[model samples]
Target: MPAKSEAQQMAAGAALAAKRGEKKVSELEGASKQMYESMDEKELEKMASTSQKDKPTHNRKS
Candidate 1:
């Protein structure tokens, strides 16, 4: 998914790093860590809803 903000971009990068074993989730620091930790399920759902609205559709014909 395309990240909509700096925090989202950083979080995505961190998740990718963790998945590749380059870093542990516990190793996250600074804004990335704070943002990740601060999100609850409800907040996550709200973010997802807003992000979905911001996403572009790919079904258009040339």
Candidate 2:
């Protein structure tokens, strides 16, 4: 599924990089760290690939 916000998309990209060994997993923090641990490469890829054009910086809880 696509990410709900820009931050989520960015986190997914960070997590994806770690998963691919382009970045160290230890370097991830916050949502990026959690996603690196819980999501597979494919899942992270999907979320990370989402366009940020219309997404908000943060998704507000309603």
Candidate 3:
């Protein structure tokens, strides 16, 4: 929807990646690392998916 929300979604995805061992917590920075450490796999997945569903749409003004 909004830029802020999109960034949050990206952070959640990064958290999920860390959980899956695709990335390290140390590799992530700032809020992303904090979010990853604060959430479990299920929670991260849920948040990521929810954000994906809320992605902004580009509608042409025809």
Candidate 4:
């Protein structure tokens, strides 16, 4: 199979982060909720990149 293009990967990552953020807002108890709610895609992508840098990789992981 072909690999995901950078744009596709970034978009998918941002979408996943946003969904996670929404769940976080409902699940977190305090300031963390507000923090996630306030983050835009650019910030979310940065956060996701930093958070995933050292993680293991696989086709299904992303």
lDDT of 1 at 43: 47
> Which is the winner by lDDT between candidate 2 and candidate 4?
2
Q: Across residues 1-62, which tens digit of lDDT does each residue of candidate 1 receive?
A: 34465456556456455545677869887745654566653444444334434444332336
The regions of model 3 sitting more than 4 angstroms off are 1-4, 51-62
Candidate 3 lDDT, 1-62, residue by residue in tens: 22236667778789889989999778999767987878888888876766446554422345
Worst 10 residues of 1 by lDDT: 52-61
**Clash-forming residue pairs, model 2:** none
Badly placed stretches (over 4 Å) of model 4 are: 1-24, 51-62
- Give stretches of model 1 more than 4 Å off: 29-62
TM-score of 2: 0.96
Candidate 1 local Cα displacement, residue 29, angstroms: 7.3
State the lDDT at 11 in candidate 3: 80
Model 3, C-alpha of 59: deviation from truth (Å): 21
Which of 2 and 4 is the better model by TM-score? Answer: 2
For model 4, residues 1-62, the per-residue Cα lDDT tens digits are 12234433343454445456544334443433443566565655564454434333433443
**How well does model 3 score by local distance difference test?**
0.72
TM-scores for candidates 1 onward, in order: 0.42, 0.96, 0.70, 0.33
Which of the two candidates, 1 or 4, achieves a greater TM-score against the reference? 1
